[model samples]
Target: MTVLHQLRRALLKPPSFTQAYGGTRTLTSPYHTENNSTAFIKPDDQNNRKTQGKWLTLPPFNTTINGASLGKNIAGIRQSTGEGNESTTTAIKWVMRCCPQLPRSLVQKLFRLRQVRRKPLESSNSVGDVHASECQVKRVSAKDSMRFGDTVYLPITVEASPTEKTECLCTEEELKFLHDLELYKDSAIIVINKPTGMPVQGGIGIKRSLDELAGTYMRYELSEAPRLVHRLDRDSSGILVLGRTQYSATVLHSIFREKTIGASNIDLKSEKRFLQRKYWALVIGSPRRPQGLISVPLGKVVMDDGRSERITVVENVSTTASQHAITEYRVLDSSFHGLTWLELSPLTGRKHQLRVHCAEVLGTPIVGDYKYGWQAHKKWNRIQIASSNLEHKIEVCNKSSLPFGLNLESGSIADKQPNLHLHCKKMVLPDVSSAIKQACISSSDYDFADIKSLKFDAPLPPHMQRSWDILSS
Candidate 1:
């Protein structure tokens, strides 16, 4: 059978909920009715219906009358009784007594009968109960810069941008793109908004990355180029952080490595503080706008078969030796554009953490993800770069029949999907020592065309550029 068929068979297995576990062990979501009785009527489940559907719509937990919230819902029950117009003294009083935690904005939405209410915040990394520490406010001067020393904060943003303006970096002639730099300080960190279709780092068999752009920008500005502190998947787009000084790199690296707050960890305040990382990806299907926190434990799947790419997640191995992983997400927008714009925040660092969590646990696989429970490779070949294209080079002489069509002599084959889809859009942090802060850079924006000129695409062979252009566009 085909790889997609195999994947479907693997992922869509019917739940055997009743075969072994029976009545008392029925699986439940954050707000299951069986747990809370008042507002939730446990539909005549007397005889125990054995069969059920695989997918689930969000549960209802809020109640309202007329146009106001009677109260919040939890464990399948409304906190207060619903009454006329849900606005006057009675409704408000009930809510005040039983559901004081229901904020006014949320109460209004519920009263208006909006969809997709927030689920419980019981998970370790959920909005409530953050156990991380806080740091004091700090700043650094250009003189104390990492290029100078970690004694000061490094400024990353180099230009200003119109608030709420989403740059459409992908153009008709270009499928791959980069962001316009707003403020690029000589030290600290630099932020570049990457466009879809470009790799953040190389080695998809060999390709260009934002790494190559630093040198070009340095030449134009006659300043030092920044170094990449974190990474974004090639097919995705958005903002990225790069360090310009060794001290900045060392400091930022420590935060991420240790999972420290402001370094890359969540603390008591739920501030989402860190050398924080966030992203906006266009996912698949019509999903809940603000949904997703895959708390499944994850472990890497290594292969002894010598395949260069790892499988990321082992199949059907939940509740095993995997490390805990939390991926928070909210849908920004969606359509048959065959994509859903998403704001993703990863709580724990794991290899392929977000990608695997999105697919296996959350059930919303990224649009162009080829591995980790998607279809396996349909065709394969070595991606090519010239002797001059690569800073380091070696001959890729093919010794056997190629799986996909190939000249074997010439090196020019892109990976499946042509372009990967995963981007690093924004990052947040609270108490970073100004000594390592890259977020301190000023903010400025650049034109789409100007951002494109920073790469070495001019020397790309015509056929390769044409294909690159086609895939990117």
Candidate 2:
């Protein structure tokens, strides 16, 4: 009998495999073909089969065998195509979706073992030999991109059910909330008005960080999760950008890094990719000058406890530990009641750069920034200037006469210790999606002007709005 017939007979009488193995070895497990059931070979049988070094050339499947489904078969050959929403998915991710119970390592092992296969991209139905090596058992990589309509073949099915699930940590309500936060979206990027108190990335005790939430729910329809391009403080609310694809993420990361390092050399109008971030902060006191730039080199200094760190203006700029930090500030509106609204634009990105410059360099501390401005807050309480009527010579605070932090109508105390008033109000950057495609065709010939710069503005958060209302009045 042929090898195919011998294998068929062996599968039919699994317990009596002595006829096939010449009574040297015995079959311990029957091949399962159910979708949920695992189709795998036992360890001894696998070793025996490997020693025999026999390759089974399966014909194009017409019907089920041993109740084996097309997609699920333990020992039976099968073909699966990349279908549904994914335009292009990695081989590893596709395998994980097909077999949820299979561990990532085992899926990778299947690829490494040449058990998984795919038809060559340039193959055709009218090609020469019927049993030609069109779908050879090669070492398929996990990162290999599987385009839509691509058929993947498997000679043997792997075990399932004993592996841990890889599911998103976010609940349905959290996902809905994140969906609402999306300010702008395209194939390449996603911009969100990040809420205060929600961290960009997870930490020691942070359960639901924005990055994790975005990666889970903010996929929209893309194959990969959106990745954070920049960072915003946990207590600050503002426009945060995310990249949907690997190429987009790399482009954005490089742009931000270049801007931070060589801010002075960059020409905004000429360089279309040049990124700009405008911030609006409410500070305790006004700057000495109405508008000017603060060029200070900042360094991280360890506090007395040795566990905590603080970013402070360093006297020596030449040190490797210190980075040159520059911020341009303009007093938008100032009130006699010890509050000033300042518009800030940072030329260089440094940790706590704006906060340190506002508090130390400008002698004005941002309102509600307790970490860097606690001393200023303790020195000044919210003084109610009762005399509403003011001369034009002095800046008149004109608006509703509502008191700060206390609602007289509701008799409820507002957020006493409000979040940081620093907000990333606006962002101007290149259209990354179009830019990427344009570069792919001919980068040298590509003109940056072909794509318009994207401008986004985020409104003030509730606490800041409330504070602004109280200050304006």
| The best candidate in terms of TM-score | 2
Candidate 2 residue 450 Cα shift, in angstroms, is 3.6
- For residues 36-82, what per-residue lDDT tens digits would candidate 2 score against the true structure? 11122234545445333122221221111111121111111222432
Best by lDDT: 2
Q: List candidate 1 segments past 4 Å from native.
A: 1-186, 202-208, 219-225, 260-269, 286-290, 303-305, 311-322, 334-339, 373-421, 429-473
TM-score between candidate 1 and the true structure: 0.40
Instruction: Please report, as a residue range, the 10-residue window in candidate 1 with the lowest summed lDDT.
Output: 150-159
- Please provide, for model 1 over 97-139, each residue's C-alpha lDDT reduced to its tens digit, 9 standing for 90 to 100: 2232233443333323321112221221321122310021122
> lDDT of candidate 1?
0.38
Q: What does the lDDT read for residue 314 in candidate 2?
A: 91
